[model samples]
Target: MSDFLSSTLLFLLQASRMTILVSSAGLLIGFFIAVAIVGACLSHIPWLRRIGNLYTFVFRGIPLLVQLMLAYFFLPAAGIHVPAWVAAVVAISLCEGAYIGEILRGGFLGIPRGQIEACQMLGLPRLDVLFRVEIPQALKLTAPSLINEAILLIKASSLVSVVGVTEITRTAQNIASSTFRPLEAYAAAGLMYLVICGALALAGHYAERRLART
Candidate 1:
C-alpha cells in the first residue's frame, strides 16, 4: 500500500472501533426508551398515551444534528454538564428511540386482539402477557424494521464526529486534513461504513429467516 492508503487504513480502523462502541451504547439506551415508550403508547391512561405521542413527534421531527447540538451546546447553557461522548449517545438514543418506539407500536398493532384475549383467558397477568406472549412475536414481526434502524444507527454515528468524538467520520476528516487527500480518506471511510452496513443487513436477513422458520 502507498503511504496515503496505509495511513487511511489505520485511521479507518480506529474510527470503526468508535463507531461500534458508540452504536452499541446508543442502541442499548434507545432500546430501553423504546420499551418505555411502547408501554406508554399501550397504556390505558389517556395522558400517558398523549405524552408518548408527543415525545415521538418531537424527537422524530427534529434532525439528529440539531439534537446533538442541543445536547452538546445547549445543555451546558442550562447547567447540564455532559461530556461529548455522553451527549452524542444521548442525542442519538433520543432521536432513534422515537423511531424505534413507532416501529414497536406498529408491531403491537399487528398482534391480533384475540391473542391478548387468549392470554387473559389463560389468567396471565398483563405484564406477563406483554413480555412473554406479545413482545416476542412483535419482535419477530418488526425484525426487518429494527434492522433498518440498526443500519441508521451505524450511519448516524458519523454525525458524532461533529461533536468531537473522533469516530470514523472524524478520523477521516483528520486524515484528509493531514494528507490533503479527502477523496481517498473519505472514500475509504465510506467503504468501511458500507461493509459494516452490508454485514448487518445479512445478519438481519438470517435473523428474519430463523424467526420465520421457528
Candidate 2:
C-alpha cells in the first residue's frame, strides 16, 4: 500500500476503538434499562405498566437519526451539556432500551404461569422466584434477540459522527474527503464493520448453543 493508504488504514484502525466503545457502552446500559422497563411492564401496578408502555412508544416511534440529532442539538439549548461521546451513547442507550424492553417483556411473559406458581409454592420469596427462576428463563429466551440488538447498535454507532464523535465511519468520511479516496476509505470501513459484526454473530450462536445444553 502507498503511504496515503497506509495512513488511512491506521486512522481507521484507531478510530474503530471508539465505535466499539460507544456500541458496547450503549448495549450494556440499555440492557440494564430494559430490565427495569420489563420489570415495570410485568408489574401488577397499572400506572407502572403505562409508564413502561409510554417509554417504548416514544423511543421506538422516533426515527433514530432524528433522535441522534435531538440528543446532539437540543440538549445544549436546554442547558444539559455533554461531550459528543456522551451524547451518542446516551441517545443510543435510550432508543435501544425501548426495543430491548419489548424483547425482554416478551420473554418474561412467554414463560408458563404454572412454573411461576410452582416456584411460588416452593416457598421462594417473590424476589427469590424472580432472580432464581423467572429471570433466568427469560434470559434464555431473550439471549438471541439481545445479541442481534448488539449487532445493530454497533452499525448504528456510525451515526455518532454527526455529533462529532470520531468513530470509524466518521474517520472514513474525513479521510475520503481529504484524500479523495472514497472507495478505499468506505471499503475499509465496511470491512471493519463486517468483521466486528461477524464476530458478534459467532458469539451469539455459541451462547445459544450453550444455553440449549443447560
Q: Per-candidate TM vs. native?
A: 0.94, 0.93
> Model 2 shows how many backbone clashes?
0
The alpha-carbon lDDT assigned to residue 131 of candidate 2 equals 79
- Give the poorly placed runs of model 2, Cα more than 4 Å off: 1-3
lDDT (tens digit, per residue) of candidate 1 on 1-214: 4887877887798779889988988888998898899999889999999999999999999999889988999778989997798889889888878999999999999999999999889999888998888889889889999999999899988999988998889999998898788999899999999999999999999999999986
lDDT of 2: 0.89
Per-model clash counts, in order, read 0, 0
Which structure among the candidates has the greatest lDDT? 1
lDDT of each: 0.90, 0.89
True-structure RMSD, every candidate: 1.4, 1.6
List clashing residue pairs in candidate 1. none
TM-score of 2: 0.93
lDDT of 2 by residue, 1-214 (tens): 5787778878988998999999989888988888888888888999999999899999999988788899888778989998989888889989988999899888998899999989878888988887788778888998898888888888988989988999999999998898888999998899889999999999999998898788
